[model samples]
Target: MTLDTDPGVAPQEEKLEMAADLTAAKEVAATDIPPELVAQSFGGYLRAWMARIRSGDSGVLPVLLGLIGITIVFEIISPNNVFLNTGNLVNLFQQSAVFMVLGMAEIFVLLLGEIDLSVGYVGAVGGAIAIQLVQPVTINLPWWLAIAFALVVCALIGAGMGFLITRLRLPSFVVTLAGYLIFNGVLLIILLLGPFSGYPTLCTSSCSGAQNNSHIIYQLMWGTIDPTVSWIGLAVIVALFGGSMWWRDSKRRRSGLVAPPPSLTFLKIALIAVIGVVLLLICNANRGRGVVQVVGVPWVIPIVLALLVVWMVLLERTRFGRYVYAVGGNPEAARRAGVNVNRVRTLAFALCSATAGIAGLLYAANQGGLSNNVNGGQLVLYAVAAAVIGGTSLFGGRGRALHGVLGGLVIGAIYNGLYLLGLAAQYQFIATGIVLLVAVTVDALSRRGAATGARA
Candidate 1:
């Protein structure tokens, strides 16, 4: 019998055709799947987030929960429940700003699996330069110019340190340690030998230490924007935040990629709005003494927020950011991928110092002036604690600007609450040490779990 006419041959050809058709049908079905349906509801979002947490991607959940716990505990322990008072909250924000900025500075280097010990004194030097330039007895440059000069000098200093690390293969820890001492001495010399030394009136005694009370620098922290302007600015911020999030999700969905649920997006926006409104209301309240009324949000809050936004964008939405993660996660792989590991590290260090400079200015503003006695060493330690506590891994490749803010708030709350309860500095130190240890422990455990899961 001819093959074409054979019954077995015909059956085999039919089976082959059927299998091809089935595969084609499956391809069509997959293409037709709607991406939005993947996470379109609140339940779906929650489930997805739970999965992520299980995978050791907890993000800010721990920090947020810890903050809540701290707040409640403090409120319960305080005699008058002053921990949650509006005025006290305002002060908490002011206190947190310095730490937040410093924590952010540390994040830049920490993200590269490196550390910058010099940020504290680097910042002091920046502030000293700015104050010296703008002081009446000194060069008396424009306030803005003074600030510009300060930032430039700090940036250059950072860049130079970066060059040495990248070109000579020096350890960042050692370089910055040397910087810590050098800048500390430099700060003292600036205060004692220059115009600051001659101006007896400028150097005033304060509780913390000796300070140079520069009117311009002091106002930067204490000054307030108009209430109307603050409201308008806040509205704009909320709108932008919501709109950006919505746009991102929409784009992902349109591209047939999984996006966060709409419900989750709205929840996030609502939470942000509530927080902003509450902050505005508290700041708008007259928290002044018996005769004077201090109203409106302090200028420093917006400045900090702006910097946070800028850094977030730089980290999340830029080529440099991707490179940073790559280098942090695996420097060898990054090198093979054509990433200039040295340049990235160098720039990271520079950025870290520049951020420290900004923090120094805020510190000076808060203290009423730059002081020779400013403890950069202690501040650097706090910055590291803040970043680590906020969820940034010491091993690098995982962190955000938001971590700094959240962590700084936690540290600030502890300090503020203790002061309110009349607790000694020793208690604050012990409490902070415990918190840092817990955070580090959690980080190590989570990383280990992630590694195990991957291996499996």
Candidate 2:
């Protein structure tokens, strides 16, 4: 919604948008056009979508299909049919909270055609700081401050690495690699020097008045919303979000601007409502094993969803997002086009690290503690893998926040399904590597298709 273009360009874009809408109204067979532009009637929209797919603009289709296929296979094969059990499924997603957030973190830099090898440990460091700060012996900062302080430090670390890459004219890979090594050492030292030595855990079950801060941190992952409250929240969210979306599209269409057909917009809203209902059903079901009656939507679900929306808006609807895309697509061109390429890159990295800090916090919450045993190297690998698998191109300038969630679900499914089958960590890694390879291949093909279209 934020325009970073000249006044003259605004009128031209408006005219083009109106023309695109008119073409859609005619239901014309358009070639080499943006798929969104040919979305007047449902039939034309479908055809345009098909054409786009044929041109290798697969979006998340492949991954979504893969996820479905994985779910089915695991449901049939896992021992005791527990793979698809509602309780187990909810727990699997809870475990995937870390992977999902980290994948999203990587997308920020990946969109710029850069890499951050240090985010895994950097996030771990943030979590460690959060834990250390609430200790009875240390600074003992408040919970909110602890979380804020950790994210801020992580952002600073990312900014420093990005600064090195932009100002020193260094390779992003090398700079981030060095950062990874440095942070790994730093993480070890923080864990070792702490009062808890190797294990610093959040206290929840037996927490007293003095330990309320620790309890709050622990509840982030372990707690759940009441079923009634969850349903009410879901209704409010759907109505507000859906209403806003419909209003925006209606306004645009009324003005003859580019917008999805009315039918298509309504269908999208209905789909969102249906998805929300399904997820709530899964979470609201009885997940407890005995008389405990543990049934409600996991707190992590809304937390991750909120973060996803924040990232999506930042990357899709803001001037900074455009600058990132422009720089990633071509830094020289972006610089020539009046963007401060270095500043954009640095800010992107800062945001990426801060996001990773959120993942770290969630990780700590899920595990009940911050420990030195975390496989940060593997974590970073999975983060990047999830982003790529979700259709983010390593070549950059083409990705979405939603892709990370989808990709993380796929990875989480693989992990959960394999573990249920008694497979080892090595097997999980092998499976993930294979999937990542396929995703990279698809990305290359997609890039080729887009290039071919441009040439045509």
Candidate 3:
């Protein structure tokens, strides 16, 4: 039988043609898939995480909730102790303030996947200069003027470091290491000029515990507030936070973006209120024994909060923030996107130093004055640890300014709580080191999981 005359043979030819048409259709479909469509399908993995929470998976909430649970348990376990005291609680906020600011400063460099070792020493240098400027025998600048000058000088030093890193294309590790040593030397040099020869002391030698005689900067920072005023301050803070949240959420809704479910927003606000009330109650309870009654929120607390908001916005809101994240994630890509990577990196370094300077000044104020032996090296380690422990990635590209608060509070709590329990500072340091190591390890694992998900 001839093939054209055979019905079975004709049907086979038609079947082959149909198969070819199917294959062609598939090819067209594959080509028609837009790159953005492909990306969106894959990038659902990168969602902001609240989705998972709304679905009831614990995610990071467990870690935070666990910390709170532990705190409550310990509070109950040590009922008579000052752990629950309002004064100590407020002091904890004050104590952690500088660390939080320093950590934020560190965040800028960290987001670029760099480290700034000079921050501690630089802070000391800046604070010392500020103190010198305000001393009686010197320029005797007003406290405000002296502070501004000190911060500016610190910024210039940072800017200088940035210039070196960007212009010279030097490794930040080596550059900042050199800065650390040079600034430490500058601190000593600035300090040796001493008590401003004609300025009698601000207080008696006994009051200052300085044979050299010093000003009561610490007293000035914390001693002036009335005990009852802390509650008012706390109320104001709560009100502001509530107002800001409402405004932001309203903005998001108006923009036609996915607003967090109102339930989620209310939960967040409630959490803040709970924490705030607890803090205020503690502060109120811890006001006085009989003699050295201390009270009111420290000036440092508000300063730290303001800086946190600023840094948070810079990292999370602006185009600059997006660039920072991009540079940290893939510098080559950022460069292709027209970012001046070197300039950004340098600025990050400078900002870090300036922040460290602020922290240093606050540290001095916290102690009431500068001391030659103030463990700058140790403090730097704590800052780094705090940044990491609060969930920042050592590998970079995966953290936020708010993490610094988490990390700072954790660090401060460990130190203050341990001290209250009579543990030596050495043990606290050792514990911090262990916590930092664990945090880094966890972050590494998380990155691995994220990468695996991306590939999948």
Query: Where does model 2 exceed 4 Å of error?
Result: 1-37
lDDT of 3 by residue, 1-456 (tens): 000100011122345556767777767455532333111221232232433333332223433553475467546654477676676677777788777777777878888887788888898887787777766555666666777788888888988888887799888778888988898888878877865432222332345233221354444345434546766776787788877876786687567554554445555677777876665565555466688765555566657767888887888789888888899999999999899987777677767777887887777777666767767787777778777766677676766777677678777777777777778988788877776787777667666655543343
The true-versus-predicted C-alpha distance at residue 1 of model 2, in Å, is 21
Top of the candidates by lDDT: 2
The Cα RMSD in angstroms, rounded to one decimal, for candidate 3 relative to the true structure is 12.2
Give the TM-score of each candidate: 0.88, 0.91, 0.80
**Clash count for each candidate, listed in order shown:** 0, 0, 3
lDDT (Cα atoms) of all candidates against the true structure: 0.80, 0.85, 0.67
lDDT of 3 at 412: 79
| Clashes by residue pair, model 2 | none
Query: Considering every candidate listed, which one attains the maximal TM-score?
Result: 2
lDDT of 1 by residue, 1-456 (tens): 000100111122345556767777767455654444365566766665566577666677788889899999999998799888888888999999999999999998888898889999999888878777766665767777878888888888888899998899999899999999999998777666455562212232242222333555676777788889999988998999889978987787678676655666677778778888999999988888898988999988888888998998898789998888888889999999999999999888888888998998888888777666699998998899999898899998988888888888899999999999999999999998898898888788878867765555
On the 0 to 100 scale, the lDDT of residue 406 in model 3 is: 68
Pairs clashing within candidate 3 = 86-282, 86-283, 218-368
Candidate 2 Cα lDDT to native: 0.85
Off by over 4 Å in 1: 1-38, 198-214
